[model samples]
Target: MAAVIDERPHYRPARGIHPLHAVLLAATIPLFLGGLLSDYAYYSTFDIQWSNFAAWLIAGGMVFTGLAVLSSLIDLARARGRRKQALLTFVLLLVTFALGLVNSFVHARDAYGSMPDGLILSVIVTVAAILATWVGFSSLRVGVTP
Candidate 1:
């Protein structure tokens, strides 16, 4: 009698950050920064008109980025089994989202100088978003096969 050998491929789960998440992070960071810079220029110069289009673009990017980060957080939680980190990321994401909303509504008055509060809020949100993104991305685990 001849011995039979089973040759079955082992199933490997998908790992690491999703490509979509990475792309979204890459895109959102620039858009968010650009919009803030444009805002600063408009405020500092007092001569240049800030484009509403840019503001809208920033808002959209923030929304998308928030969603992407949330997705990544869920993935990280599952892969790394770190619920605390995920929870903190979620809180930061919410803060960023709220700040973005406030930024969109508050407009700089042309006659008056730039609003210091708005600028400060924007800076805060930008930093928080970046931090959250870094944390979420770092927690992801890449699957390697040798």
Candidate 2:
């Protein structure tokens, strides 16, 4: 038996997003989810403090979402083969940020009045965050796996 060496070039696609963008984008999910849980707590317990927690969490989520949006825009412009996926991820992050802004405003109202609507917005924002994260990550891969 003769020893033989097989030579095959491995193909690796460029990363779809920068590491900082990924970190910022990943941060939004937990923050928004926290906001949602806080909203639910407020809704269930009717406590004003939970609204405050939700507001702060939403604000934090917005901060990260905004950063992610900017980074994604840069990624979109830089991307070559993955432009469409990058654009979709950017749009999703933008939508999440916008909804989070609205949710923050809703949470700013009187604790009692903010309910239902605030909770509703929280749900929407959380779902958007999840979808954005999913789409962003799912689109990162280039080829079929064995």
Candidate 3:
């Protein structure tokens, strides 16, 4: 038997996963934390409704972000091929942000003048989502496999 070496350079980062995963972790943690803070703020502020669409979207996005980041970790267990995990994370991240994209257009007119909070929250979460996703993309495994 002959020892065969990988002909192609592995997608290993010279710096390691810290650059991507850490940054993503950093971006999303805030939305999750802010959800709690915002809830407190709303509760303290009078005449604020908690069960509205904006509340759900923001709170849900934060939770989703936290879950996805926790789930899609690239480590020694599946380090050889973590592309699938990467893909799943990408999809969830998209879904998390798509909510924002939808709200942006829907809140444009604001006929009732009911404070387009969903739109604002959506914008913030979407930006973080997009940035985190991009960082993940950079850390993704490229090239073909047999």
Highest-lDDT candidate: 2
Q: Report the CA-based lDDT of candidate 1 relative to the real structure.
A: 0.62
Q: Name the best candidate (by TM-score).
A: 2
Pairs with steric clashes in candidate 1? none
Better of 2 and 3 by TM-score: 2
lDDT (10s digit) by residue, model 1, range 93-125: 677777777776664333333355556656776
* Per-prediction TM-score: 0.70, 0.87, 0.38
Worst 10 residues of 3 by lDDT: 1-10
RMSD for each model, in Å, please? 7.2, 4.5, 10.2
Q: What is the C-alpha lDDT of each candidate?
A: 0.62, 0.85, 0.50
How does residue 64 of candidate 1 score in lDDT?
Answer: 74
Query: Which scores higher on lDDT, 1 or 3?
Result: 1
> Of 2 and 3, which scores higher on lDDT?
2
Off-target runs (Cα >4 Å) in candidate 2 are 1-13, 142-146
